[model samples]
Target: MAFESFSEFLAMGTHGPYVWSVYGITGVFLVGMVLQTLSAKKKQLKRLHSILVKDVSEREK
Candidate 1:
């Protein structure tokens, strides 16, 4: 399945659209997952910080 030229490689023998679209969609999905994971971790850390502060304040009183 060797392409004789760059044009043929890009065309992917008429299956270019499907192959390129799949790659694009997969890239977007991976980026979205990474962002979601980062957001969740930030939220969890904020909540933990608040809880720790409250515990310390309670002990002082």
Candidate 2:
């Protein structure tokens, strides 16, 4: 199906709304998951670093 113009392509013969909505939702999910995973990793690393430092200080004492 050849679209006469860009707007026509977007309309997608009346299926555009559904198609575009699904794409938008999927994009949000992917971005949200990546951010959440990174945040969790950063927190874990910080906690581990503090624990290691405490252990080292105790050994010196």
lDDT (0 to 1) per candidate: 0.96, 0.97
Can you write out model 1's per-residue Cα lDDT over 1-61, one digit (the tens) per residue?
5999999988899999999899999999999999999999999999999999999999999
Q: Candidate 1: misplaced stretches above 4 Å?
A: 1-9, 57-61
Provide the TM-score for each candidate, comma-separated: 0.64, 0.71
TM-score of candidate 2 relative to the true fold? 0.71
- Cα lDDT for residue 43, candidate 2: 97
In model 2, residue pairs whose N, Cα or C atoms come closer than 3 Å (at least 3 residues apart or on different chains), thus clashing, are none
TM-score of structure candidate 1: 0.64
Error of 2 at 11 (Å): 1.6
